[model samples]
Target: MPLALRDAFIDLEQYERLCAAAGEGERLEYLDGEVVRMMVGGSTAHHALTRRLDGLIADRLAPGGPCAVFRETMRLEAGTARFYPDVFVACGAGVAPDAETRGVPGATVILEVLSPSTERYDRGRKWLRYQSLPDLRHFALVAQDQCRIEAFHRQAAGWHYELLVGPDAVLRLEAVGVELRLGEVYAVLPALAAGADDRPAQAAFTPAQVASIAAMRGLPVSGEIEALLAELEPDACAAAVAALVAGDGVGGWAAILPERLHARLNARPDDASERG
Candidate 1:
């Protein structure tokens, strides 16, 4: 017999009605019958990057061509999911505008700005669903807390993965003839700081300790790499280091640090540490 209760996940028809009743408010996304609210992100850095990329992408594209850029205001469907990508490029004919939402005509490229809470979902489930779209030629993940991008481009055989690091790294989508420079993309961000997505809202390590750790990682370390140490939670190879930092209030943790980092940063001759 059919179940007496309603379904856990809604169908596309139900999703449309929900969108209609949603009216004007926070953005909503549907995936595999689940509705998710687009909250817990929208950081200042996220907004700044989104705005800057919009300008850069728009500037590079020829004006008034079939190819065009769309912001978060636009929505696209992939199999059973609907996503409001931070920025996307669609070519060929345009989807007719609607009252509630503007559907994507054909998404050739999609880029999403990663946030702490939503990073997993964006990279995993959402990414899998997007593959169902036949026109999606390229997809990129923008790291808000650092200068990095993970891009995937569709190929005849399968998808090709490319990791772009450092400020000089360039993102090129051959399908649409689009290129994004990392330096220009990260200009909106400040000089340097470790990525805080894996950490609490506040920084976990002191500035001096971070610098010291950066030096030990390698002589004349890259500032980008230095800023990334704050996000790396070491494996449970060293419990003593975690205890010391936890008690000293140096790294702002009661426990949870790498023994290697302790041997390197804690043994510095300039042991005088200053908190950020």
Candidate 2:
């Protein structure tokens, strides 16, 4: 989600005051003289990717770790900008003891899970401002809609860019001496995985993807599904999976129903999405 700007302006000092008085779980950010309130509880894909990346980076580091991975809850200070990145890593004594509402001066690496609304700003001004942090060695933009990672590494000469795509690509974080596989990064997304191919039938529901969907829908994993898949016509099964991967889970289903029936159902929908 994108930040909602308030009708007010503040410097770094006033930003700290607001943060101190802000309620628990409330997150506020400052950039270019604007006070931005972040929208909490982003899409399922965003949270899933963040959780996976956090663990992947943290696990690879030593226990107690030379550098610690911080989630969105941690505040990061970059030159004149004060914002919370989705995932970041800071090394050594940058974190001050007894500092509660404060933040580390900078970070070794910063990452943001790109949302449709904020992708441009994140890759532009935010990325430019982050370059001021002397200790910042890497910055990465994680895509929530697909299996891709765009990274910028600081070199002695300047910055180098790298793009990693597909489930097989690996992201090398030399600053922290860790690597993240795209397969592991997108584990919860049923449509993508390590070594995934364009075989529509085979891609429909791999064992791991089936398990993930089952867990999400709270369905039991009996042998029945395997039997049912075998009994269904191959073309029909393929078409059904294609609908699911098409993005709108409901619209895909509606397209198959008789026009009259679909219209009636849409008028009185009772899906979980409607409840919210």
Candidate 3:
């Protein structure tokens, strides 16, 4: 039977009880003080890949492990809101307050399986919200239809991005002390003839991209100044340029970086060029 769609209101307490009662039966999420039913049936490809990835990580953290691997039902806190990540790895033992409660400042890593309907929100609004969490160490955006994945690692200052080109690139999860090859992640899915070299070009940032980068940096809304700011942080600007050049600008690089750091980075670029 298909799940029913109803605008059901539940606070954090009530949501806990409801989720516990449902068990593994139907899918629900807390949105605007209401429990909204999520699409229980995902695409075959999505489920296949999700299961494979989940199994691989869980198998790794079986007994006396450093972390706990959880699937769809585990809720992670982001500001006042709660998000149900597709897969997550929590470094600590007490992710949930109890068996019935979702985690609070729990997950070290969060994964989002991207689809056409969710690609924008996952990258934009939701991504912004996730940034507010201090415990979150990394965010992995998995492309459901394509042979691509983007991982963002939170550094002391800000965040950095890594792109896994093909099914051969080894992805390292330093935050969770694990490493996964692209093959393991994409296993059981259809074969991809494309290798790293045959994959699409990398993303790069250009002068035009400065505004977006500056906005991410929390700079004022101006293109020229933003471009100048980008020039100021040549490394960051170079990263953006590289992403634009590679054609994957929409990847996580821009969002992962904090706005204030860009201001500090501006000094380095200016100091270097002044010496030359």
Maximum-lDDT candidate: 2
Of candidates 2 and 1, the better by lDDT? 2
Residue range 49-122, candidate 1, lDDT tens digits: 88888888989886766688888878876766788888888887754434456776458888988877676567
If scored against the real structure, what TM-score would every candidate get? 0.65, 0.67, 0.65
For all the candidates, what are their Cα RMSDs to the real structure?
14.1, 15.7, 8.3
Candidate 1's C-alpha runs over 4 A off are 1-7, 192-276
The per-candidate count of clashes, in order, stands at: 1, 0, 16
Pairs of colliding residues, candidate 1: 194-227
Local accuracy of candidate 3 as per-residue lDDT tens digits, 73-102: 667766566667788887765554444465
Local error of candidate 2 at 120, Å?
1.6
Q: Which tens-of-lDDT digit does each residue in 1-276 have in candidate 2? A: 356557666778888888888878778888888877775667998988888889888889877766888888888888788878889988888755237765777788988998876665675456667877899898888887677787777777556666677888888889989888888888877676643545432222243333333323333333433333344343344343333322223443343222434444355434523211
Q: Flag regions of model 2 displaced more than 4 Å.
A: 96-98, 194-276
Q: How would the candidate models be sorted by TM-score, starting from the highest?
A: 2, 3, 1
TM-score of 2: 0.67
Give the Cα lDDT of each candidate: 0.63, 0.67, 0.61
